[model samples]
Target: MPAQALATLNPETEEQDRRASVINELEEDESVDEVEHSTQRGAPNTGTTPANAAAQPDIGILPSGQTQPSAPDTPVAANVDLNDVVTAPESELLAMQLDTLPMPRPAQPLALLGSEVLPGTSARLAWSPGIQIPGLSQPTPVLAVNGIHAGPTLCLTGAVHGDELNGIEIVRRTIYDLNAEELSGRVIGVPIVNLPGFQQGSRYLPDRRDLNRHFPGSPDGSLADRIAHSLFENVIRHCDMLVDIHTGSLKRTNLPQLRADMNNPDVATFTQGFDRMAVVHSSGSPGMLRSAAVAAGIVAVTLEAGESHRIQEHQIEAGVNSLTSLMEKQGMTSRMFVWGDPEPVYYDSDWIRAQHGGILFSEVDLGAHVSEGEILGYVADPITNAQYPIRANSNGRVIGMAVDQVVMAGFAAYHIGTEAEIPAE
Candidate 1:
């Protein structure tokens, strides 16, 4: 199918088809092993393990032409008592036989804005803070999937800017694809954080406010503030880590990359967990969710993938795989996930903007490597057919670019990530 045609298809339909195709492919691959162990929902008893475990599939070769690391040896049954395992700290529990240990009893109902979600189940709650028009009194949807086992909570938020649709789909698949019965930690997902803006296909709220710029908001402030406050205080504050998914705004599209404050030890650990995606070290702007979460001592990072207003399948798959890797790194799951390659880390990036208004045509695609003074694209006058070449200013990788379309003078056309740096914590 043509790329344009695929973009025009119903997003929900496309996602369903993608999911089915992935399942079919997995089923056909004899090398892939099925996870046979199952745990009882809402049971305080330790989960049961498969009598005979299956061998994990080989993860193939790394980008450097080396074989990927082999999976860890299957865990042997431990002699420790189930009661001790249940009461032990999470770090110690991870080293023991997890499946053979009993889960800790859920303490209390997880309270939210206007609802309470119990453990061992999922819920779609609503958050309405009394700000509603007559016909559009719809409340913001808050989805939660609490696992039967006791572990850290990971919050996945998407569509902070309403028009960014890739994250919404990423969150949907991440929550839906997870098996709550076998899950260890709790996952809270807010797929569409800016509902009003999403309804109008706008990045900003109706009141002309950028929802993302007003994080850790005030209860008695503007509409954006109230919404931000409700989410930060009621939902985000309870999380141990936050992954705010996003896409390029306006006319730009990004390569699958992660941005976080690499200076912070906790944030660095979380950022490194996305083994297959590129990482850009950045101390996020103040009032941004990542910045606020870090200030509140919650490990946080931002994922930027694809373009806005469309669901790209490859980007979605990348996002899903990154999240899965994160789950494994945090010991939230026992599943063995091996990444294909270690993505390069870039310390700084620069945007190449247009010098004159014209029709823009990109000569290179996202992730293309370019040297200083190389032509990345061209801008041409629609009537006179006069053209001007846009060149890279530094040796770097094309991390982001605008779609082929009419552009104005000084508009951001290409983004280059330069100065590749050693991975740091």
Candidate 2:
């Protein structure tokens, strides 16, 4: 019988059994034991099932006789103190809906990156710092489209690493495709933030410092810091929500997914706006733009598409479609977007590393599901003509991985995504 039809036979008992069954499956699986000892934050922790996760609460599956907190009453942008909520027991996160903003964002002009964009219009602005890099006379580009009606300001920033070409294209296609008159909220797109690195075709700033690590920057700090400060204050501060687009760094590639801090009710809810995209639970590292934005009360999430430096059309198309669906969900667009089945939200992830340095080749493609102990790839020594098979430690899906190339010992190779029970308080 269909589960839904069976669910009606004994609703209460069925629900309790369902929750218990999920926990039992996780605890009973031998692979789950291996996952508990593995590294954190690679793809997602492997093992367990989310068979009924879509029907469960966003925070987590609930136990019998327990009720979640009611959704917040105010709009997400009212600057609510989320510290208490985020710190609350995991159960409360299931019901908090912080993105419930009042409709029609109060039709107003948006002044961003030094340009005044009126309602129902679009403009191209420039973002330049007070202390510019040598020979960087040209300012960075910022695209804005102010909707005819009022709504939230949704910001899309790309190319923060300079060589992440896929992000630049994603931002361009998303913004240009939107019609200003049909939009509800303002859409701000910055196609390139690290122009210096872009010009040099490198991932770091001219000083070799990573621009991504200096978020919510200081004007009196290093070159990267100053530029981060300008962008954050001038461009980012005006946003009600932010999606900092990115691709895999170095030679790694990611299945189209979102890295989000699920503890934050606002961020958790905001992630639901995307359609058919996997959600990987991550608090985000310090100094990351997504982390900094969340700290500033903005609902934010990082969208990871493909590998860096290359513009893959399939990745670009997936990103654009997801963004379009998000805008539709957020009421920024009048268009209809039919959403697909909810993608699994991996609560835990870990990266499996190579044991030996050699020319590596993957057996499983990105997004492939692998059983525990399955061979993921082989690391073959070019000089000795010997090969070593790299295997998965737990059952999971490949969410991120290194491209076929020479690898070093301890190189992160495959990222595994798994669903697991959030421990009881």
Candidate 3:
């Protein structure tokens, strides 16, 4: 199926504002893994904010070759920093400030990919009359065109958890701006895939089912199970690739990054095509959509972005740019975004759990660096007010840390990066 013609530009100021206002702080966030960037800002990402997928297919998606930058140039933070200038009541803060930012134009799909090598069969296809959600409903799905020109069917999903809504915004932007004229393959986008959870502003579904844990579900099971089952059989099985987008849980944040099966070259290639974004290896869950896709012989990966329950511009851009980056990699589109060099750090991240239940104090922010045996934070008894320090077990970076001060003994404190084969900078 051919991608429909490009829609006329209808930039949503509010949406764009949402991303811009938050991007600066997020970009400079010390916790995230840094990537060298040529442009002023990084890329965009997928689905709704509520909460959180798939498969194994053959001939994993691999890039023919990677385009290397002249040098790994880490652009310094602008001298006129947005963080220093923008001042507002915390409640009235904006998402991103991208008015002065440059953009990557939509490349002629055929010209960018070289039509000679693109799939000629016109395997483009799309689903029909997608159901709509209740709250925050604008730019209805009917007005949207989710098309795939050729090659394979890929699904970009996000906001399975309500608070994790960055992916949802990313998907929305993709649909609003998709120019079908240059598409080479099928792309299915599920922005705010978990509408019920998203509307409730919670991670779990309205019925309290963890959507990620209920995949390949049963029609006769819980509501989440049925939906999961339907998605698996009806939607997931049809795709050649799957990318799930996410953010850190409430008050938590992640740098723009990807998690996929490193052993599978295809999956690795797809993950790497997301230029300027860190790639982390993961063992997809048995019930996960990534695992489901893997099992179905489809190559899939999880694209993680900034913190949860809040929208950030850089992350949304990161999500969008990553997909487009893959489009460039797959020769599906012509537009090539000039991006930054990524500081790709590999780690088997581990959680630093609170040793004893109490009110807690955290010193470092998410994306901060740490050394082995370093103190992550401290826990204090509420009644007794006894403080105990929690320390790291190994040297690595802090990808995420608890935002709330109150803590429980089992609650995770610091999500620390650990031993992995990080590509040298």
Candidate 4:
């Protein structure tokens, strides 16, 4: 039976059936010691059945698309001191509705990152890493849009690696299109997380550190560590969910897709919510924002789109649509937005590297499906005009590829995702 249909069944009957199944399993078991231990632990004797457990009252939707019962009018977490989080004026809180979704509550003030952002208001807060130059100090911008009604706090962060421009624009547009009065929960956006690297148009910090490799930061550690610690403690720790956006580095472009730890059922639902993008199951590297946030018990996912340093309109638009769809799925907005056709979900992916050094060109675009032994592109020696065809080693879709440019032997040129058949070496 469909999980959605099962969710609507009588809860009492379901529990009774579950108990009966446990009893049958216990009766059939021949191990006396195991049975005695199970009896003492009050454990179910049968292997657990996969069932759609009753959804939490606070969470709005199930993975099966069924709506959960509305929660009672409970106050926000008392532990979250709202005094530091600012609140907007009543007039501003009631300003305008950007969508048709019903508001869950009147706007209320919330505080974050040492600033108070009122309900129905959008504000840009700043964070400085305490690194002062001769006459200049750079402060990273943290954008917040608090909704009139109450809902889970969703944080959208971008440009962790300064040159990843697609995410910066994605976060900006996603927050810009929202109307505070119409929104149900809060949306926090950090468009440029690596200010110094972004200013330099580089992928690493001025100190030559990859800012992304340090998380849950240390106050007494290096510059990167301090910045990470500050953001994690002051901003990320407050979010109920997070979407860390990125782009391919080093002249590579990625198809608009999701790289997430789908092993987590909640994370899997979040990935599936972005209907039109491909999903690559990944736990992510240590110190990554996605990994750290998940470890802190926040549901998080990463969205990779296009190449670094330049904004691709198609990729940006796709990201915005996917995020908006996700908000709608979470009941954070009443907007009626439908995602296009679904994309493939791959459990594994590999990169095809160049065997010879030369100027390069691609025959296929990002997101194109290719067959085993198919010609993907060619590497040409500029002076000699010698062309070498690049072929796919296995059947798969092109999730990422290097832009047309000079290349070196062993340079990763194409990233292919496949469900079966290992690529030929």
Residue 143 deviation, candidate 2, in Å?
0.2
For candidate 2, write residues 303-406 as lDDT tens digits: 99999879999999889989999999998896768888878888889999999999999999999999999999999999999899999999889999999999
lDDT of 4 by residue, 36-79 (tens): 66542343446563344432113444566877664455565567
Which scores higher on lDDT, 1 or 3?
1
Q: Residues 1-425, candidate 1: write the lDDT tens digits.
A: 33444353336575556556545655665642342332322324344532211111323334465665554663556787766535457667776767778766543456766677676778988766556775868988888877767678999999999999999999999898777666677889999989888999999988999988899989999998988888898889989989999999887899999998878877776777886899888899988988889899899999999999999999999999999889888877767787777787888899999998999999999999999999999999989989999999999999989999999999999999985765552
Q: lDDT of all predictions, in order shown?
A: 0.82, 0.84, 0.64, 0.84
As for candidate 4, its clashing pairs are 85-110, 85-111, 86-111, 86-116, 87-109, 87-118, 88-118, 101-334, 217-229
Shift of residue 113 alpha carbon in model 4, Å: 1.7
Better of 1 and 3 by TM-score: 1
RMSD of model 3 against the true structure: 28.7
lDDT of 3: 0.64
Between candidates 1 and 4, the one scoring higher on lDDT is: 4
Candidate 1 TM-score, C-alpha based: 0.74
Model 1's alpha-carbon lDDT is 0.82
How many angstroms is residue 192 displaced in model 2 relative to the true structure, after the best TM-score fit?
A: 0.4
Q: State the weakest 10-residue window (summed lDDT) of model 1.
A: 50-59
